[model samples]
Target: MARSISDTGSVVRAVRVWPVAGQPAGLPDSLPEPIAAVAVPPAGPSWPEHRTRFAVEVVGDGASGWHAPVSEAVARLVVDTLADGVVGHDAAAPRKLAYRPRASRHHQGAHARQAVSAVELACWDLASRVSGRTVPELLGGTVRAHVPVYASALGLDPAHPEAVKVAAWISEQGFWGQKWPLTKELLRQGPVAVARVLGNLREAAGEGRFMVDGLRRCRLDEALGLLPVLADLRVAFAEELLEPGGVAWARVRAAGAGVPMAAGEHAVDEHEQTRLLTGGAVDVWQTDPGWSGGLARSLHTVEVAADLGMPTFPHGDRLWAALALAGACCRDKVPAVEWHLTLEPLRQRVFTDPGAVEAGMLPSGPGIGLAPTPVITSPLPVWTVGS
Candidate 1:
């Protein structure tokens, strides 16, 4: 049972990680203004059909949640790392707690970063609960009641004809914009094939803005070369055309990909962002609080972007990042947030009321206000932390 939310000292007592079914009970009729068929992309290495998250129920006292677009397991062994850093700490000190894992000498590789991010999200949830506020409200009340959202069609394999149809259908609906992923196969087909798809999507999009996620589908020069074609297609931005921290980013600006270029979704600190932006490699900054070392780091990244006049846009299809960025976007920290059509109602199911959107904007609430409900597709997989 969940303990009462208290203002006094509350410490994380136990942590639970569980897998929830990815498919929604039913597609929500509300979002995208006029509902249309948005194809769910077949599961890929980046996004699978299952949802896994961490929940921290205050042991001695407070609250918490999980994020990431992947379901890589949180090792039972790492509980020690998390315990040493967070188990007994006050829930209110989220930044301090979120950094504890990194502060420890044991941090290693991407898995460690993902582990820390999970705990950090819980900390923010705990902090919000203790303060009787939503994370956004605590960050400072939002700038807009609802942040503008773009439909993320990462689930669709863009090279397929289904993608074109789905793109046309959803574009007819009201959304701030639409983003499609570039698969390895599509990129292998080279610029000619790429142009055809973008052109078709642009026509299908009507007036809706179109964007592309390179997903590292092609070489930097090749990605840059497509700029003129993308410009004609009116693409809003091209994301991750090259590797996140690859040497090629420094040379990207000189190549002048006519359309806007975006990177940094995998970047965790201002230092990383600075090196990427310093060279003018790309025009936009993509930061995901969940992926970029959690809320504190994300805020710091936004401030860093402001210093460089770079627009902040958090990238991902997960709820933790979605809600976190949504709060920040409402506060005007980010111009817009990405809402993966794949996660859709399934992601919202994890929340307590999960709220609703009006005119492409999500309603604000307390503590991110999400709780895991039973997923009917399969038996729930649960992980106990600090056991």
Candidate 2:
């Protein structure tokens, strides 16, 4: 046996940490009882001793890419921070070695963005299988061929029956666009009581065109008094009204507000999404690729909002990594991609290779491009990397 190259780069090539358990593959495992937890760090006493929490089902294939509905202390802090910092590097350089601060010294929360988004999506499915090309042509190709999605309408009280079974599965699931998130007592019952609750959510989105987050909860006179009743209930945009550090956000963009004023989801990188595109407070940028620090910083905020023409909209769990980075971006600045239907069916039932996201596009399929449908009713125990 001849060993060279500095003793095979100083050995260190053994990984097999396991601790699997299952209960999340897709819709209806269970959860709906005033269920709302976000406890990140509390209960002092120097916490860390495997407090035990559970959830999983973020699978992928064509090589590797599965961060399953994480938790179990986010898969043991991503397999103990990738077995102590990315198992000896070069796992295809995982986003240039996990953003190098010495691989963020034992990493941080959200299991360090789900172990750097599951080893940077399995190092981009092993660099699209060594350049055979996929994963959006190694992240800089393809522009369309579908990829539009937008459902995200979690439960809220429209007389809660799970909000009429989540508005009848977002109007019989041919999803295209939808949004929720409006609690501040429903914007303080102003603007004609929020235009009679946007006319009962435009009759539960029958024709579909929803979207009205108001995540920050408004206040520029309550988003200019709910913008002329959400432009007479057309209501398709207005997310995060205002609250991401501002310089008046172009004075809430001249208080026109006929609609369209989305915001970056707690952004903290890409130079704050180029300062929310130089303070226009976003005409639409809703990012959150693991909170602006993954998917190459949400494709560098969709290439700086497609060179300031502004039109990016990603904020929703890894829908195939935001539809494989919005199908290689630049389609008039990324038309859409946001889906949390029934609050993420355990990350959309493990994707066993299949496709269907109607209205708002996303057709194509196969390898690193939509084709999974794993909805295992129950089966858990299979974490691996080493016993």
Candidate 3:
């Protein structure tokens, strides 16, 4: 069955993009900057010192306003191309509208696709609000209310013992799964050391499943060499073993290694996403709605992978990014979303209770379900396009 959004009779009136910073309004108020810096693992993406995030707000002539955070590259496009492109366009079929940019842009890099992604999501969010429904409802409803999550983080320096603590904390925090980088360990101690660390992590994680993020630092031979250990510890997937679109994908897929390989955190548009998923290059698809050209295309990628029975685990570095996908992910199909325990406090700074993980499920609320703190909203600017 082909999917196309039918125009529902609403027109986009305006779009606004801005940078924001704030403290979490949810329970357990915002942490002090110094404390937050200490709280998050050193290698995580978002840091307290650099808590600022880009946001895209969309308004409709008939529908209420909606907004979501944009990362990588959305500001320029919002003020230039996308703002003009979306105004006066039909608002009902967001994914269809998203196709133009996906095809038109030649060298669409991180920022370009991020703006497009933000626009697509703004349309869907506004439409969902207009229809008095949730984003997931528009996407055909979800399989469950609460989404299962995996604790995702990075290990400290090679000599540091924080990997054990990070793994232990993730396990005790109730996440059903865990993913941590082997950057320093692998560089300092080599594959054998990483294998031992993983074994220790498996012990620390107890019943939780384990996943490894190579951060594009693991070589083909290194990752291949670790397969036996991966199997021994029952590791689920090895992410970003080498640069995306490299021969490594086919090699691993053909190696009969039995270890599922994952990538796509850097996919900028549909074409790259297609190349990654269409040929069975990777077994597990790891995309970021914020970076993969937006929520619309990200979901499309998820659908494509789902058809092939490949699980979709959208990156969880950005809390808002995860919130946007909650309604679309199914427990049986998608399985888990990534969450960084150390960054939760900083994540809360942008929105109250960004998305709560309880008993291993992420239950979403209505209409973006997040409110910006005053630090990020004061003197807010809203851009409008005329009829």
TM-score for each prediction? 0.79, 0.32, 0.82
lDDT of 2 by residue, 270-367 (tens): 56667777766667776766545567768877787777777888777556667777888855777778765444544444445434456556642345
Per lDDT, the best of the predicted structures is 3
What is the TM-score of candidate 1? Answer: 0.79
lDDT of 3 by residue, 14-107 (tens): 7666566633323234533322332434433444424445566666655544444444235556656777767666556665675443324443
lDDT of 1 by residue, 163-225 (tens): 677676665556678998877787777778888977787787888888988777668767766
TM-score of 2: 0.32
Model 3 Cα shift for residue 266 (angstroms): 1.6
Task: Look at candidate 3 and tell me the lDDT of residue 130.
Answer: 62
Ranking by lDDT: 3, 1, 2
Q: How would the candidate models be sorted by TM-score, starting from the highest? A: 3, 1, 2
* lDDT on C-alpha atoms for all candidate structures: 0.61, 0.56, 0.63
lDDT of 2: 0.56
TM-score of 3: 0.82
Clashes of 3: 7
- Pairs clashing in candidate 1? 13-59, 41-155, 143-330, 351-370, 351-371
Better of 1 and 2 by lDDT: 1
